[model samples]
Target: MYNIQGYFEVESVNEATALLAAAPHLLVIAGGTDVLIKMHHGQIEKAELLSIRKIKSLQGVVKLEDGTILIGSLTTFTQIANDPVIKENIPVLAEAALTMGGPQIRNVATIGGNICNGATSADSASTLFALDARLKLQSNQGERVVPIQEFYLGPGKVDLKPGELLTQIIISPENYRGYGGHYIKFSMRKAMDIATLGVAVICKVKQGNILEDVRIGLGVAGPTPLRCPEAEAFARGKTISPETIAEIGKLAVKATQARTSWRASKEYREHLVEELTQRALKAAIVKAGGEAIA
Candidate 1:
C-alpha cells in the first residue's frame, strides 16, 4: 500500500477546493473505489488525500427548472441506475451504470471517478457522449461547464484544471426526450470485466420510418470514447432496413482505429465494432417505437 502523507475529509465543495488549491499535490477521492485500488496496487505514490465523499452537494440527482438534469459528481452508480428521473429520462445511462462492476462496486463507485479516470473502456463515457452531457468544473475562482465529449484529452488524462473539482454532470432535456437509446458492452464475461468493446446509440425517428437524428458513441476502440459522426450522418434520414444498418456497421469499422491487445485482436475488435454498432442501432430504433426490419 502507498503511504498517505495527509488525509483530509472535506464536507463541502468550497472546503475541498480550498484544500486542493492549498495543496496541489493532494489526490482527490470521491468514492475511493478507483483511487484506493491504485493506492493498493502501488500505482499511486505517497501524497495527501482529500476525500470529497462527505460533500453533501455532490450527491443525488436534480431536475432543474430549465429542463436540465444535474447529477452530483459524487453520485454513485447505484444511485444513477435506480434514480427514477434517470431511469425515465436517460435509460441508456442507467443501463450503462448497472453494467459497471457488480452491485457492491456500483454502490461505492462515483460517476466523477469513472469519468475522471479517462479510460476508453469506461462504461458510462460512451453513453454520456451520446447524450451530449456536460461537466461542471468548480474552482475557487468559479465554475465552468465543458461538454463531456471534449473532456478527455487522452488515456488517463482530462481537461480538469488544477484545484478544479468536477461538481456536476448536466444532461440537457432535449437529448433524452422522445429519443430512444441503447448501450451494448462486449466482454469476455457477463460481469466484473472491462468492456472489450462498448457501443451506445441514440436515435430519433421521423415520418416514413426514417432516422431523423442519430448519435453513436463507441468505447475501447480508440484512444478515447469516440463518436462515429460519419455513421450517424449516413444513417440520418435513411429508411431503417437491414441494408442501411449493414452499411452503417461498415462505416463504424472504417471510423475506428483499434490496436491489438491481450483481450482482443485488432481484426476481432474491428468486427465487434461493426456488429455491435448494427445491433445497438437496431435496438435503439425498436426502442424509439419503430419496427426493425430484421
Candidate 2:
C-alpha cells in the first residue's frame, strides 16, 4: 500500500472544503469501501486523506417539508434497506441497496460515495437514476443541488467543483406512488462481482391501467448510469401488456444505443437492455400487483 502521510477527520462541510482546496491531490474517503480498496490494491497513490466519516450531520435520514425523503450523504446501505419508512414508501431504493453488497460492505458504504464514484457497475445509481433523484452538494462556496441524472458527464467523471462535497440525496415521495419496480443484475457471481449489467425499471400506473410515468436505467450498459428516455416515452400513457412491454423494451434498446457509450459494444448492451428492460418491467408489474417479482 502507498503511504498516506496524514489523516484529517473533518466534521463539517466548510472544514472539508478548506482541506480539499489546500490539497487537491488528497483522496476523500467517506465509507472507505472503494477508496480503501483501491489503496489496498495499490491502484492509488497515498497522499493526504480526508475522512468525512466524522461529519455527524451528514449521516441521518430526513423528511423534507414537501414530503421528500432526504438521505444524508453518509447514510449506509444497511440503513436504507432496513428503514421502515423507506420500505413502506420508496421500496425501490430499498431493493436497490439490498443488492449493493454483503452485510459488512452495506454497513460501511455510503449513498453519496456510490453516486459520485460514477462507476458503470454501481448498483445504487441504477435505481437512483430511475427515481429521478437529486444530489445536494456543499463546499466553502456554500451548497447547491443537482439532479442525479445530470451529475455525471462520463465514466469516472462528475460535475462537482474542486472543493465540493456530496451532502445529500433528495428523493420526491410523490413520484414513487403506485410504482412497480425492481433492480436486476447479471454478474459472474451474486455478491461481490461487478455487474456485467444492472437494470432498474420503475413504473407508476395511473387509474391502475395506463402507465403514468416510467423510468428505465441501466448500469454497465453505458459509461454512466442513464435513463432510457425513449423507453420511458414508449411506455408512458400506455397500457401494460406483453405486446406493449415488448415495444417499450425495443425503445430501451434504441435509446441506450443513441445515448450511452458502450464499453464493450453497442450490440451486446443494446440487446441486454432489451431483455433486461422486458424482465424488469414485467417484474415491476408483478410487484405492483402484490405478487413476488423474480
Best by TM-score: 1
Lowest-sum lDDT 10-residue window in model 2? 256-265
Q: Number of the top candidate by lDDT? A: 1
Tens digits of per-residue lDDT, candidate 1, 61-180, equal 999887799999999999999999999888999999999999999999999999999899999999999999999999988999999989999988999999999999999989888899
Over 1-294, each residue of candidate 2 has an lDDT whose tens digit, in order, gives: 757878888888788888887876667899999888878888777567899998988887877777898889899999999887788877878888888889999999998898878787888988988888989988776789999888988888889888789998988977676787888987767787777778998887666556777898888766788788877877778876777888988888765533334334567667888888888888887776633333
Local distance difference test scores for all models: 0.91, 0.81
Residue 153 lDDT in candidate 1 = 90
Which pairs of residues collide in model 1?
none
- Give per-model TM-scores: 0.98, 0.91
The runs of at least 3 residues in candidate 1 whose Cα sits more than 4 Å from the true structure, single-residue gaps closed, are none
Collision pairs in model 2: none
